[model samples]
Target: MITEFQLLDAPAVPTVVVKRAEVAATHLPELFDATFARFHAAIAEGVVAPSGPPFGLYLRMEDTLDIEIGFPGVLQSPDENLVASELPAGRIASAQYWGSFDGLPLAWAEFVSHVAGQGLSVAGPCWESYVTMPEPNMDPTTIRTDLFCAVS
Candidate 1:
């Protein structure tokens, strides 16, 4: 299947994140599901609390990976416990994946190839935005993800 994604510039915003390491593609669905579920629950229960227009979710990776669910606007640093950082403004190459998370790595590979083919270098870490709400009865096959790579 051909994955299609659009590139755009996204501004920095406040986010809440959880760190994990050596994650496999097979288990990513559950990881994403559980991580976002907790983030969503926090929003619903007024735990983390939402501050602005909820649009993008970012994943920052090095040796380990950190998944950050970004809320729109600048969120307050409650008890000064949040790990919020301002991501510098830059160009990004993005694509939309409308399927199970199993195919996400491949989709991201395509994005990387596309960026390279354009003679562009990656500027920052990559992340996937969960643009749609996950339903209990919904098939993972029908889930949607927006993969993004920061570029210069």
Candidate 2:
């Protein structure tokens, strides 16, 4: 199911991220799997956490190492390596979707439709936050994800 689009002033939160020059669509699954693993491992071991799945995660792009990804309170800025912030604040246009990441295009279409309907435009690249582990054996109909577009 698709969710109503909402423009929210999202609070910053701690995050763990990996940088890539270009993430081709063909590699999304592997990228997501590895990233999700890092996030999950952090939470499970108390290195960084919400005690469970995150409400969402942010993906920011940069031509240089000048990037930041973060969660609430804690922020990290890496130099010359595509900085990953743990806390950064901004406006977010978000939507929630259930089922596997394979259906992400549908959700993106929905999100795009919602953004247009609201007369707002997406400001940056999209981010997909896992609400459940990415297990190949899991039912595709049961996975949940929160998709977000940064708002300028």
Candidate 3:
């Protein structure tokens, strides 16, 4: 669960982008693995310098989700396979979670409520950044994910 929330003006970061137009919720695990694999391969191939932690950008989520998975990076140049992109930019309602990712939905619920409590409207896409990435089979209690709800 979120312990606190904040409003911040965010700046976009360059990324090694992988996006899906449509994805079922059940398919998210595989998508993250494949997308991150591509990110690592690009790193191994020296295509981009890992500039920051990984992120999951959510454009829309209803019957299906519009998503982009990527790592903020300093690209050597634009590669066709890995498009160079940027994360959402502007004002945002932010929340920090320091537990298993399974608690994310609830965290988001609190984040929106907190934003509304402050008289703000969510106006754009949202995203979650992996501030400290968890290793394979790592204890979820140690994870750190920073969520952002873009707002007007």
Candidate 4:
């Protein structure tokens, strides 16, 4: 996997999410699909226009996975089930992964190594922005996900 490292002045993005802890790898697909469906429904109902692609904000990744899955938005949702949160603004090391989600760990490993090699340390939770939505006949290689981990 090819990775790129850059400094970003990211802005805080509001989002509606479903927070989950210790999520099993097998359950992620279903979890994300259901969560995003609810999010899109809210978007359609005029809650907010999606500011960006869907993302999974990783709060914890060791021992157990903790994450919030949802869409970035301009307005907070009135639906109480969808928790409103923000993606913090800061410097980040990022990479674009062009394949299935299963290959993500490799991409992340390379990204983290690059960050450390540059004498930078992770400063916060990492997130994956799904830049391209999956389609029924879409090729896995064509899928795009941009991964980011805050660094300082």
Candidate 5:
């Protein structure tokens, strides 16, 4: 997939998140599903309205990955396990990926390379904006994810 490079002035996003450290790749789907369900439940209870697509905010990616999976919205009385947080706003490099989530690593790799090609440096943890929800029978090609990396 072709990775497009662009700059974004992202605003602070109020979010409800499920944080996990050293998460296994195989467990991601379930974690995301559970997190979304909880967030959706909050919405069902009239806690908050959805303001943006679901996102995976990566805090670390070394021997283990530390991340948060959640939805952005206006703050509400979150449940015990959910915490309200803000996505920092600043200059970033981004690209839209039109394919399965499985292809994300490749897209990110290209996006990073593209950023470097432009003489920019990554300054913070990367995040993925899940633009399209995937269904079991859905075509993988139809999925869309917007990737972002804070840059200096």
Candidate 6:
């Protein structure tokens, strides 16, 4: 399920601690877990999130997905494990998604189709902002993910 799509001016994110990965679709869960684990470790080392929520930047989606996952904030100490980066400024077409993670592929496909139907060109990396992350004992239907695709 998804909410009505909206196009908004998305400002450039100045600070972020991201870990890039190239992995097959089947490994996403483990990839997210490890990436978030790196963020937690960075927090212990003085990284702060003064910007926005956690996000996954979908750079490329082919046979293997190229993704960068992390929180929006400064990575004071750059290391080999994690790098500092920013989300580009642009117009973003977005919608709120409801349900479990398993349905995201279809959701994204639908959303992308809708964006294309609007005649908006995808200008940059698409992303998903995690509004309500999955938790133990929580209903799968309660999950809320906000999808954003940078559009021209």
User: For model 2, how does the per-residue alpha-carbon lDDT over 88-146 read when each residue is reduced to its tens digit?
Assistant: 35888888788777787788788878887887887765666666656768788788787
Please write out the lDDT profile of model 6 over residues 51-132, one tens digit for every residue: 6778888889888888888777777765667777778787989999999989998999889888988998788889898889
lDDT of 1 by residue, 1-152 (tens): 32675678777655555455456535656765676666676666565655543333445554544545455434433433334544445787877778765676687777788888888878887766666656778987677777777887
Please report the TM-score between candidate 5 and the true structure: 0.91
The TM-score measured for candidate 2 stands at 0.67
For model 5, the local distance difference test gives 0.84
Q: Model 6: clashing residue pairs?
A: none
Instruction: Candidate 4: count the clashes.
Output: 0
State every prediction's TM-score relative to the real structure: 0.69, 0.67, 0.91, 0.90, 0.91, 0.89
- Model 2's C-alpha root-mean-square deviation from the true structure amounts to 4.8
* lDDT of residue 36 for candidate 6: 80
lDDT against the true structure, each candidate: 0.61, 0.58, 0.84, 0.84, 0.84, 0.82
| Count of clashing residue pairs in every prediction | 2, 14, 0, 0, 0, 0
Off by over 4 Å in 3: none
Q: Deviation in angstroms for 25 in model 5?
A: 2.9
Per-residue lDDT tens digits for candidate 4, residues 90-152, read 787787888888898898888888889889999999999999988888898998899898999
C-alpha root-mean-square deviation, each candidate: 3.8, 4.8, 1.6, 1.6, 1.6, 1.7
- The digit string of per-residue lDDT tens for model 3 on 37-130 reads 8888888889878888899999999989998888888777667767777877899888888887777888788888888888998998888998
Question: Candidate 1: deviation at residue 59, Å?
Answer: 6.4
